[model samples]
Target: MQKGKIGVSSDNLFPIIKKFLYSDHDIFLREIVSNAVDATQKLKTLAARGETAVSVENAKVSVSFDAEAKTITVSDNGIGMTAEEVEKYINQIAFSGANEFLDKYKDDANAIIGHFGLGFYSSFMVSHEVEVVTKSYKEGSTAVRWTCDGSPEYTLEEAERAGNGTDIIMHVNEESEEFLDKARLGEILNKYCKFLPIPVVFGKKTEWKEGKEVETEEDNQLNDVAPAWTKKPVDLKDEDYSSFYRQLYPMGEDPLFNIHLNVDYPFELTGILYFPKLKNTIEVQKNKIQLYCNQVFVTDSVEGIVPDFLTLLHGVIDSPDIPLNVSRSYLQSDSNVKKISSHITKKVADRLSQLFKENREEFEKKWDDLKIFIEYGMLSEEKFEEKAKSFFLFKTTDGKYFTLEEYEKLIADSQTDKDNNLIYLYTSNEEEQFTFIQEAKNKGYDVLVMDDVLSTHLINKFEQQYNNKRFVRIDSDVVNNLIRKEDESEHLTVAEREELSPVFQSVCPADNGVNYVVDFKSMGENGQPMVITRNEFMRRMKDMSKLQGGGGMNFYGDLPESLNLVVNTDHPLVKKVLAEKEAALSADLETVNAALAMLKAEQESLEKAKEGKKEEEVAAADNEKLEELQKNISNLEGEKRGKLEAFGKDNKLAKQMVDLALLANGLLKGADLDKFVRRSVELIN
Candidate 1:
């Protein structure tokens, strides 16, 4: 027997590997199994080159657990290390400038492990003692055994003869006794070796015997050896891709569609990306895209590797060129990753465009299920935004669909405003906003249905993307103003508006944190007596603030809602109210107006005299007189308004009109709505 220490510049190497080399010690199984695969692959390469004399037909790797002995072994029938090769590869740790390297990278041990070729040593992380019994394939070569107990020192000695191969036997440590469990070992093997190019066996297949699962004689292979992504796209059928998706996500719903990526020129990347039925919540479905390196499972948290929006997609991405840190625990940013991300974004856009071009009716049929993903991608990725325009769709309230260009053309002539800007009318709820939608349709305009959770952000993005284009909700304004074609003619003179303003104000609801403004517009006599509209800018800000939940926008979300009470001057009911008010308050309003005119003329004369003068130059006596006159005029006006308010209170028509408008807008609730119902009954009677 010959024994020596592992050639390392530091005595603390083993401790570091056990404690910090990998973020999670569970990765030790992946590292060991990967090494075994590498050995198997290399032997196959040499045998194919006619450089090896041994038969290569029955090559395989196997993992087994011994509960009684508290040991787990990974064996491979492939090229094994000779004693001399072990001395060079296993004994000598490849890290140069050991002290400085450790000092500089101790905090980044997980990343440094792959860089310094410490894969084999990771076995010590979960085992108190590890033994490597290897027999080289070289003719006349004797078998050798290497044993170490989580230390720098090791023993090398001659062992019993065996077929050419290697066996890694680990005596599970007390802290890591979980590795000794048969089910645990099977789980680790399945996770890391599920798609390996070579078959990996772990115990025998099981069958239901009596009432419990019993082992069968057939070997239970854990990996597919040739997953779907490894094959060419032309060779795969639609069902093949779908079957692979089901294999990856057993419990996921049927995908809406998929994008098969197989690129070779810029960077080697192959994967099947499935568009799952994403929940309205963006967070609950993220990190479902599993990333792989040469069929070895790296991670599912592929946020940086793919575009942020693509994280909502679920599937497997297997690429040998993706850069992985030491333990493959996470992704490292590099040019290849960026190129891959851009490629994926392009592929996704291309697939959607193709589907749309092939059969638009089918695309529109699936739009509801696929809306959030496409919108998110367009909103977040600029390159994707440019590509998405080709296939993006807008569904009208009437259940018709149009592309961006097509929709713009369909509404360009009529929806264009006096300012030459095109307006897109949209409704959040087809049922709740049915009245508003019908009104818009009555004006020869189409209203779109934008009810997705991300619609607020998406429309905001579209406004920036297109020139002279605006998205207006159906209920945001009166039908005439929604897409104004020309300047509106005055329906009521200043004197007539002043006489009626206070009457509506008195009957309008009190401050419920909602600011109400009374306005008059001439729709024909057939228009509704009253309707409510909201300012577009303020409403959008509030909606976006609720979605973003941050910054000064949140202040907008907390502010009171403001609505406009639009009374139709042409409606017979509103006209009747105005005529009644004129008859009741005409005498009182006439006297107040005469006195108010005299006080206003005097105040104007005084203000004209002081127009260009500084405050000191204006006489204090004149200022005082002007203030007294203004106060008297204001009091007289207040008295006039009081008379009008009293008249409005007594007139149930005014209150009923306001309630009708509120009800149209879905704002009148509870007692107020009940009052409207009772008043309507009495007025009809």
Candidate 2:
């Protein structure tokens, strides 16, 4: 036996390795298994180069535990370290100065272990002592044993071995007794080694025998040596991708579609990304994409690797170029990482565009499930937005789909207003807004079903992208005003507007967080007597606030909804209400208006005389007379409006018209709805 201290500069290295070398002590198994894989791969390379006589068959890494002995062993059938090589690699921890190392890696344990040549030392994290018995693959090379007891001092000696391989034996410390549990170690192996290029055997495969699981003679291989990502895309079938998806997410729903990513130009990247049938909430489905380094699982939080939107996709992304062992902050600044991100976004956009072009029917069929992801990508990645425009679709309320370009052309002639703005009409709920959608369609206009959770944000993006184009919800405005080509001349004069405004306002629901303004429009006397509508800009901002969680726009969301009580003046029912209102309050309003008009004329004449002169240049008596005339005019107008308001309250037809409008818009509810129903019955009778 030969004894010597490790060549590390400090005696503090052992303690640092134990407490700060890995983020999780359980990762010790991953590091050890990874080393074993590296050895096996090297042996294969050497054999391929005619450097060794070893056969490549039955090459595997085996993990087994002896609970009674309180030890765990990971053995590999591959090129093993010779005594001299062990002394050089294991003794000399070739790393930075002690203080520099601690300062750099004190916060990130995995950085220290993965970046430094300390994969084997990580064994000390969960072990009291570690032993390495290795036999070199070179001919006539004798096997050697290395032992260390969590200290700088280690012993090397000659040992008897049957074949060229390596075995690491770990004496589990009392604090890490969990590592001795077979199930616990098996889980760790499954997480880290499930996709490694080597077959990892954990223990004997179990089968149900006599109603209880029992170990069978077959070995339980915990990993697949060649995952689908390592194979050529031409050799894969749809079902093959599906099977791989199931392997990655055992309990997840089957994906809607798969994009086999294989790129090898600027940087090498290979993996399968699947479009999941996501839930309504994006946050719930985020961080599903697993990142891998050479098939070794690194993390599921792949935000830095994939674009922010693509994180919703679930599957594996294996990139050897991505730094496997580094802090997340380091990854954010990696140029290769940024390139990979851009490449992935491009690939996803290309796949979607291809799918749309090849089989638009199929793409449209899956659109409901795929829309959220595409919208998210378009909103997040600028390049993706530019590419996605060709494939992203807008589904009409009539169950037809069209690309934005196609839809714009289809509606440009009919939906463009006099102001040259193209109106893209949409509805959130087809059933609730059925009347409004039908009205839009009745006017030879197409309405889109913009019902996705991201639709509000997405349409905002679209309006910015397409000049003079705006998206308006179907219920946001009256059908005529939604895409007005030429305004219809007002069929009602000012006197008519004054008489009907109070009649409609009186019946409008108060304290409902809605502001209703009465307006008159001509609709060929065939349109509905009344229609309730909201302003597009305010409604959109409020809807966006709800979707995006306010974000300082809560004022719009919290303010009462402003609605338009559009009373069609051409309708016969409204004409009857106008006539009745005029008859009921005509005498009172005329008398008040005569006095108000005379006072207003006197007040106007006095103000016109003082227009260009200073206050002192004008007569003080004239100013006093103007003020008295203004007060008298205000009093008479108040009396005139009060009579109209009284007539509005007593008129049930006016209230019925207002309630019908509210009911059509699905806004009348509770006591108002109940009253409308009862009044509707009485009016019918």
Candidate 3:
């Protein structure tokens, strides 16, 4: 027997492998099993070419655990290695520079997994010593046994009378005794080898006989040799897909749909992607989709392999093209992964489009559930955005479904402004915005309820895609201003406006966290006295910034909410308030107006003669006369706004209207809300 140091130039290889790799130590099982599978596959290829003597009809890989001997043995019926093959492959360390080897793979998990021809060496990670007993299927080959401790030294000798293939035994290490546990071994098997192409047996089937679990005579295979994804899509039924889903996730609800992805041209990719019922926000549910390489389990963390949105799906993806590696950082940059991601997105969009075209009624039934996924794709991927335009839906307040074009046509005649820009009105809450909805419906305009968190983002997307179209929240503005044909207002004289400002200002709450600018509009007598509304652009920007992004929020949130306190001056109640204020402050305002008219006439005469004069001449002319007129006018307006505030403070009707408007906007809360309710009761009584 002869042995040589592992062909590494430096002694630093062992420590690097132990520490940097300790994080992914569990991958050792996958590597060993994969190597076994590779050997087995090679035997099959040889047999297909008439190279083997043994009848290769059926070959299996068996894994056995011995608690008493503290050992784990993997026996595979594959192309066993001869003594010379072991000497060349196992005895010589293959003096290759370890740095160049490790440099060749900066982050590929597959490279370090079985590198340096170290498929069998992984057993040493968990075991203090490892033994390999082999009988090659080659003609005139002798059986051999190889042993190695956790070091560079190894021994090879003639030994076992094994059938064919190899048996690798690992003596459990002190630091890794946990792998000796039956349950632990079973868990590792289930995690990394549950869907192998060949049968992989772990132990015997257990039975609850004599009040205890006893090992049954039958073998307990731990895998489905022919998983659903491996079969032809035509050969499977809905129940089969459902069963496979159950097998993948025993506790999950039934998936809404499944897309069987089998592509070979651009890159080999096979999987069953299930659209699970995501009733709430997308939470990270790990181990939902198991990745496989040539039917050998690799890992469940497919974030790099699949798109971010696809993580919400649950199923299996097996590809021989994906090399089994140790570093995920390398796979993330793999060109093939991007191809796979695009293909999956297209396939998903195609599936939804097909479903909608084939059975629209069923698609409509699931639209509410399906909207989130389609919306996410549209917002994230530009390509998906293009495809989703065809199948995307718009729903109306009247419980009608319409495509974007259809909805545009339905609202075009009535909702379009003078500039021909179409307006799509929607509400976040049907109950809270009921009054606004009614007002819109009163004018023969439809409102769509958009309550999703992504609705703001989706609206932004819609405006970008649809020409001369805008999405407006139902309660954004009053009925007339929403789709303004013209700004037609009946002007009030300065004296008249000064009289009515106080009656409404008196009732408005000072502590409410909104700014109100009062406006007297001459609507029909039937209209409400006051309507509170906010600008749509400011409101939506503030909203979307809270989600999709976190920028410009301080700017928006810190700014006082701009609400228009529209007082319908034509309403009889408003007219009555003006008359009452005039009756109350007539004497004071009359005296001030008379004094102000005389002063204003003198100033206008003085200004009319100096319109084209130089600044010095105007300044010289404006001496004592200008100072006195300015002081008098300022004092009058100051007294007037103060009186208006005073009147607004005492006028319960005015306060009630302001609060009512706040309540309508869902902003009346806490003590202010309490006062509104109390005032509401008093008014009702």
lDDT of 3 by residue, 441-473 (tens): 998888986777778888988888778998888
Ten-residue segment with the worst summed lDDT in candidate 3? 107-116
Q: TM-scores, in order shown?
A: 0.91, 0.90, 0.88
Better of 1 and 3 by lDDT: 1
lDDT to native, each model: 0.84, 0.82, 0.75
Candidate 3 residue runs with Cα over 4 Å from true position: 21-23, 55-58, 66-70, 91-118, 280-289, 323-332, 490-502, 552-554, 557-560, 593-635
**How much RMSD separates candidate 3 from the native structure?**
4.8
lDDT of 1 by residue, 234-311 (tens): 899999988998889888789998888898887879899998876654656655898888788888889988988899
What lDDT score goes with residue 408 in model 3?
77
- In candidate 2, position 421 carries an lDDT of 95
Rank candidates by lDDT, best first.
1, 2, 3
Give me the overall lDDT of model 2. Answer: 0.82
Could you tell me which residue pairs clash in candidate 2? none
Please tell me which predicted candidate would have the highest lDDT against the true structure.
1
